[model samples]
Target: MRLAELQGWIVNILRRGSVLAAGGLMGAALAAPQAAQANLHQRYRHVVRIHERLGGIASPAASGPLAPGIDWIVMDAATGRILSEHNAYNERFPASLTKLMTLDLAFHALSHGRLNANTPLPVSPAAASVQPVKLNLVAGQTVTVMQAMLGMTTLSANDAATALGQYLGGGSIRRVAAEMTARAHALGMERSEFRNPSGLPNPNQVTDAYDMAILARHLLLDYPQYRYLFSVPSFRFEGRTIPNIDGMLKRYNGAIGMKTGYTDLARFNLVTAAVRNGHMLIGVEMHAPSWIVAYNRMTQLLDAGFAAESGAPTTVIATATSPQPRAAMPPPPVRQPAAAPVLVASRSRTAPVHMIVARSVGHVTRDMIPGWTAQVGAYDSYILAKRQALTIRGERKVGIARVGSAVVHRHRIWRAQIAGLDHNDANLVCSAMRRAHQSCFIIPPSNESLAMR
Candidate 1:
């Protein structure tokens, strides 16, 4: 072969060898990622098993016939360990026990200046109409927020719950109930649902003992400022003195205030938080055959929890993140622009930009408007899209608007958006949005946008 032909042949062979080597490297890179992912899953599974084993202690059923009616849970308040559980997650009507949530919100309101101890909350007609065990608060009459809290907690007054709900939620008991459900979910009380601000006889108002225990833990951990409200033995209101219904408070040492509930369907429900030996323990018993039985069972659980730490070598579960002192609740929510709407040929072809709705300290109201202004863009889900609205309350603005099932299901996530803005404002708003940790992007309007209509 001539010298030029030989050189050409050598270059071709080198190129082929390089291609083979590159292919092998790419294959190894892809396989390496999968191997790493599998290793991570294995590690996670191992940790999960270790956690489960550490938590797994056989809870012997309570002694004797009384055990059948008793459903209980005992937890280490600080660590959230279930020291013992018996039927903890069984569904039961919450009865007056539902007031704990009401009190929690009331306490939050007082702390944040949404309402104050001395603030006069109006007694709406609905509030006055609540059947109970009531303070007999007359409609159009007003009671101080402190007085209302005392009435509700010490006396389990349904009327007081309604009054607070009306005052804080704009006279709509239903709206307050919805807010309660939302708050409950946020607090991780997944097994609980609320139908009214007051624990009226709604068939739907039910929760598990375990869930109530979680709520009790949050109240103790997050809102220690209002702890005194739970401990009141007697509340004198409207010239009438009503003693606390929780008999355990007077009988048990270190007994803190918690609520009690009873109903035909729910039977008896009690949530008790007590501190012994510098350890706080929360015990919940629900649907007990009798009130006294429930009370005794809860006490027993608390005693056991206190005893669990005694003389036994403590195995610290490092999983619990150190508890941070409760901070103020978030600001009120704000509404924002809807996710990107479909575009038409007649409309401008400007690209939509994500806009942040609002920013504030603490939890925001679910309904506040995001910003005074916004741009627009297509989003995958209402939730994802809402991150761009500059307001803390933008989460609630997300909702599904149907363009077509294919588009909706494929990108069910919400995207952030603002309406008409010049390029400079859009860029500025987007930058601010990014600082707030919102996900956003710009999208050019096109024929595809027309399909949204």
Candidate 2:
């Protein structure tokens, strides 16, 4: 036996000298010393149980279930403090609400300049095949990224969900779904596991009310610029005008558009948010028996939370419209004119590195000029590659004149480079760039030109 175990036995024997004849107790101590420690762990659990399960319900369960097995929560959107919850962490099917993560990834690309709203997204047979609650896209038909977002949001289009996943995953739906799960973990949605982008009936997919509230909060706060995407009442696409199905957006007084879902298994899932008097509350209801029950319960919770005179001072209500009934969709995205910001070179200490602005869509072409090149990073796809190059170019406007892509090891990759420079200039540029904490390497610029030729 280990020294510690032996000491425990001796202490037990000394404490109960007359009980030595009860050899069973001694044997139990020797064979199951861990049982004693387990009690201590139980005590420890009681102490630590005072804290929450990280991002979880913080308020009292003031009310009971609206219906059997219904999970719901009301959270202060700004502080993310749970004002009220009921079975909030019980795992349940999410229905079409899975598109939130897919849309989250799309917005990430948009804000990072990796995707433009107008970028044409092709619909593959797999993407087109997602049934019911779908956009009915045909194989090989295409829609812009914004159009897809509209379809997904206003109509809960499963096809749009699949298309966005494929577009973001670079033609791999499974990879995008995996990315969604990883992103959910990173966001601290501990009770969520998504199997598909459209939240279809998958035995493996599940999430709870607490996790949905977390996602709803992030969707509102993280990308406020894209908040406009969620609220449109109707969108005219092709020949049909698709109307948003979110009843909260239609009827709730202060409600903004969030999402809605329904399946025999998931059964009336809705995530709704509202703002009144500079206060916001997000409500999530999953697996309600009927849509009426879900919305009524949600309305009751939101009404109580909003009416609570708790005077919470940490929250700033989002000022965007509730995405309620609105007539025309927002205008199509137009390219903003490039700022003509001049780059004042810092002290040129022999070798100077400069980050250049990306050329505007209408800028002068540098494709004809080619020599050696130096770049910072390689991208997995040409679109992402070009986007990164454009980002740095637009932000700093330095040595980046041309961004190019090549298939390396059978995988398409993009390189951020200072093109059109001679060998000496390229080396100098790379050395200077390295000083700025950017890794750089020179590419055979002439070889790329020849290959393109």
For residues 89-148, could you state the per-residue lDDT of candidate 1 as single tens digits?
Answer: 445678888888887778778777787778989888888767655666788999898877
**TM-score of every model versus the real structure:** 0.55, 0.56
Q: So what's the TM-score on candidate 2?
A: 0.56
List runs of model 1 lying over 4 Å from the truth.
1-68, 312-453
Q: Which has the greatest TM-score? A: 2
lDDT per residue for candidate 2 within 1-453, as digits (tens), equals 479866764564343333323333354344344334324422111111111322222223322112247877777776555666666655677888898888899988999999998999999999876654555687899999988998888768778888888989889978888999988866766547888888876655777787888888777776766765666655667654455556566457767768888665577788998877656778998987666677778888888788652554423221121111212222222222232112112212223222222242322222322235667566665555555555544443444345556677777666555554446767776776678887878766335443121
Overall local distance difference test of candidate 2:
0.62
**Any residue pairs clashing in model 2, and if so which?**
231-323, 355-398, 356-397, 356-398, 357-393, 357-397, 357-398, 358-393, 358-394
RMSD of each: 27.2, 25.2
